[model samples]
Target: MCGIIGIYGNPEAARMAALGMFAEQHRGQESCGLAVSDGKVIHLYKSMGLVKEVFTDEVLKTLPGYIAVGHVRYPTKGAATKFNTQPHLVETLFGPSYALASNGDLVNYDQIRARLEAENVYFNSDNDGELLVKYLAWQIIAKNKDVVEAIRCLMKDIKGAYSCVFCTRKELYMFRDPLSIRPMIWGKNINGDVVVASESCVLDILDVNGRSEVPAAGIIEVNADGVKVIGNNPAQYRQQNHHSYCVFEHIYFSRPDSYHFGENVFEVREDIGRKLAEQDKGLEADCVVPVPDSANFMAVGYSAASGIPLSLGLIRNHYIGRTFIKPEQTIRDESVRQKFNVLPNFFKGKKVVLVDDSIVRGTTIRKIVRMIKLAGAEEIHLRIGSPAICYSCYYGIDTPHREELAANRYSLEEIKERIGVNSLKYLDMNSLRECLKEPDEYCYACFDGKYPLEKE
Candidate 1:
């Protein structure tokens, strides 16, 4: 997964984009990039590091423009190399320049890239965002189509979850797939500058006005004329089945303060915790302790419902990025070690209910459980806020293969034994659906393996 933002009609577009990227730093951390269009030229700057590290004052000053696009890379479809870093820019022979940044993975990227290569479209990197920009450039420059027409054609040809923002010297564009598997929202600032980003949190941070979601299967364009929705054929773009917005965004990915799919992310997680308490009604514990950060709200609900006092048993290092966003397993493991520390005083001689978002590989949680045990917790009850992630996600989340997921490999009892926890429970699907505003509209592919896209 990645974070993408576009700024239009603002003289300090690069600065605003930098702020937006900073607000979304949690979404990605391997690398960050920015591309700014000064009406005469598009200046690009990117490096492997955090957003703050990559966009120092000196770097931002160099990227002067009234239109800008930014990206934070997490390396889902390509290696964590400089070549794969984004805000991918494409220049045509006729002098038109376009830069693109995206937030989701493409299922048919290989097929599309092969076809483009056969037609003599050279490629610089394996990054899906690069392929996407190239495809758009091909349609607009080679096929002689307008931006809207090219995107409409693209919607018909491309298959996967892509919530993207594209910018040119004169205009900005944003779009999401029919399923809306990833989030993208747009709004205008008080200064009449239009902005689009992967989450509403960016809009809030940037103080954008009239913020609203970019319509699913829809294209939004912002130019000198202001914001306009452009699509000649709406019926063709309409989703045939139930919309499959990724439910995991609520469970873990999104910021608590952000709203997506008509629900507050923190509220949904709190509700999940409440339902978890309802399901495991008779369980007894001295206190409810969240794994920290993402699961904090969930544990609050669990504490409120179960009538157990909440305690900060695990203290997170705010300096460390999320372990899950790290590219390699070894790095993730090292990050986990540095990410949290157990509060021995809180756990000593206490029976605690340990609340966490979800367990993917079971490695991190197992280590956490051991730490709590070492702190003198008599009984450690693991309560997960989401269902077991048994399948890999093709829609941008970095879930491991089915066989690598702990749930897919072991039974509940076996898992409990492996994690060295006294007991374990995950939120049931019924409870999960009950907590959401529109359960039918959400995707549970990782938990249930019901992909919205047709399987190859």
Candidate 2:
């Protein structure tokens, strides 16, 4: 997935947009970009790297304006390269150039690209962002529709999740898909300039929380005039039926410190851990050991619920970046070890409940279980924070197919054997629903296999 932000009316909008993106870097670590408009023309900069690494002073300083939009992206629809990075700018019939950044996958991208290509249009990159821009430009150019109407029409052609922010020289706008599979929130800044972003952390980081947050899966447009909502007709999309938010965001993608869809990810994870503890009631675990990073919050919940001390038995190397490619199998195995180091003293002779976010292809967890054994942990029991991932996500996440999933391929007992754990306890799907006060409000498609959007 990705993160998008926009600001209008503030003179230092470009800087504000940068701040928003900096807060949103965790959502996507592959590339970052920004576009600013001074109520005239648009200026742009994008690079394939982290937000801090890509948008340095030289890049950020180059963008000057009272209005700006930015994006931090990870490649789901295209390859990781500067060519595919976003804040894609193109002038529309409306006036100055408009830049767009998206936060989710569109399953219909292949169909849309093929349909457009047949009409004598050539493309520069195999990027979904490019295809979206081409479609919007074509709609405004070919159909003579206004930007909003063009967007409305174009969205009808898109399939899957999207929580996006768009900006022209004049206005800042935000939107999410009918299902709102992704998270996008907006608040007002101290200057009364609107702040629209994918995470509330942007508002927290920028001190822009006066305005609570925008409604999900709808349009939020802010200009010098004011902010307004549009295309909020739930009936329109519901008439066709496409709705399911991604539950994985709360489990892994989003930072526990952030807020989205009115649910605190940290709290939800804690609830997941408590529920996991409930399922494995009275388990004899000496301490809870989190699989550094993703499972930290859940570990705390398990520790509190089970009355076991939480220990940092495993430490993560912060320098292991989001993008790392290994040319050999041996190197790949070594890379996992480098990312995590077991504290021999902390884990030695302990009955450890290893808290991990989720198990996918099975190899990593299997290897990690072996590693902990070598670390002298007396007994290794596994507790997963999220329900066993039995499906692959066609969305932004890098998940393997259902058949390839460890859970899908093996029974509970078999999985425990494969992972070499004393026992494996997974949070049940029903337990997941109970954790969320409102089940319909949340999407458990991955667990229940309820495909909201039509498949490609």
Candidate 3:
């Protein structure tokens, strides 16, 4: 997954995009970039680092423009390198130059790239973002189509999740895949400047008003004329069975404070914990302890439902970036040691109910459980807020291989034994659906292997 933002008609467009990227740093940490259009030229800057490290005040000053697009990349489809960093710029020989940044993965990327390569189109990076821009550029420059027609063609040809933002010399364009698997929202600031982001939290950060989602299978344009829906062809863009919005957004990917799919993430997570408590009705524990950060709200709900007090058994070091987003397994393992620490005397001789978002590889949680046991805790009962992730995600998330996922490789009892936990319970799939406002609208492919798009 990645974070993308576009700012239009703002004097400090680049600066505003920087702030929005900072707010969404949690979504990605491997690299960050921004492209600004001054109505004449598109200036680009990108680097492999955190948002704050990449976009300093001096750097922002260099990107002078009235419209800008930014991206924080997590490397779902390519290696973590400067070449893979986004806000990918494409210079068209016959049409206006444009930059594109997207938040989802394409399952048919290899086929598309091969077709483009056969047409003599060269590639700079292995990333899907570059392929997407090249495809759009091909339609615009080679096929003599406008931006709207190019996007419509993209919607028809691309087969995966993509919530994208594109910026030209004069306009900003945003569109989501037929399923709307990833989140995208648009609003207007007090000055009537249009803002679009992967999440509503950025709109709140910018004090934008009338925050509204870009329609599923929709294309929108923002310019001096204001925000307008260019197209909304749900019938042509719709997936087979349902909308297939990514459920992981509510369970873990999104910020608890953010709202997506007409439901508050924090509330849904809390309800998930309550449901887990209902499942484990006879569980015995001295205190409910969250794994920290993402699981804090779920632990809160578990505490309230189980009539147990909440305690900060694990203290997170917020200075470090999230370990899961780190590209290398070695870095992820090392960061886990530095990212969280056991609170002294908190779990001593106590039975602790450890609440965490979900277990993917199970490496980090295994280490965490070991730390808790070493801290003199009598027992560690692992409670996951989401259902077991038994399958890989094709729509933008980093879970690319089934073998890498612990749940996919082992049974529940085996998982508990492997993690060295006294007991382990994942929220049931039915319970997870019950917590959502529109249960049938989500894609539970990662949990249940029901992919919205056919495997490539």
Q: Cα deviation of 72 in candidate 1 (Å)?
A: 0.8
Please provide the root mean square deviation of candidate 1 (C-alpha atoms, Å).
1.2
RMSD of each: 1.2, 2.7, 1.1
Q: Which stretches of candidate 2 lie over 4 Å from their true place?
A: 91-96, 239-243, 322-335
Of 1 and 2, the candidate ahead on TM-score is 1
Residues 22-44, model 2: lDDT tens digits = 88776777788888888787888
Residues 1-456 of candidate 3: C-alpha lDDT, one tens digit per residue: 899999999878999999999999999988999999999999999999888888999999999999999999989898988999998999766558989999999999989899999988999999988988889989988898988899999988888989899988999999888888999989888989889998889999999979888888788988778778866767777547568889889888899989889999999989988998998898889999998788999999999999988998799999998887788899999999999998887788999899999999999999999999999999989999998998998888888889999998999999999999999999999999999989989999898887778768
Residue 169 C-alpha lDDT in model 3: 91
The whole-model lDDT of each prediction reads 0.89, 0.76, 0.90
Which candidate model has the greater lDDT, 1 or 2? 1
Clashes of each: 0, 0, 0
- lDDT-better candidate, 2 vs 3: 3
Model 2 CA lDDT for position 445: 57
Structure candidate 1, residue pairs in collision = none
What lDDT would candidate 2 get against the real structure? 0.76
Question: Which TM-score value belongs to model 3?
Answer: 0.98
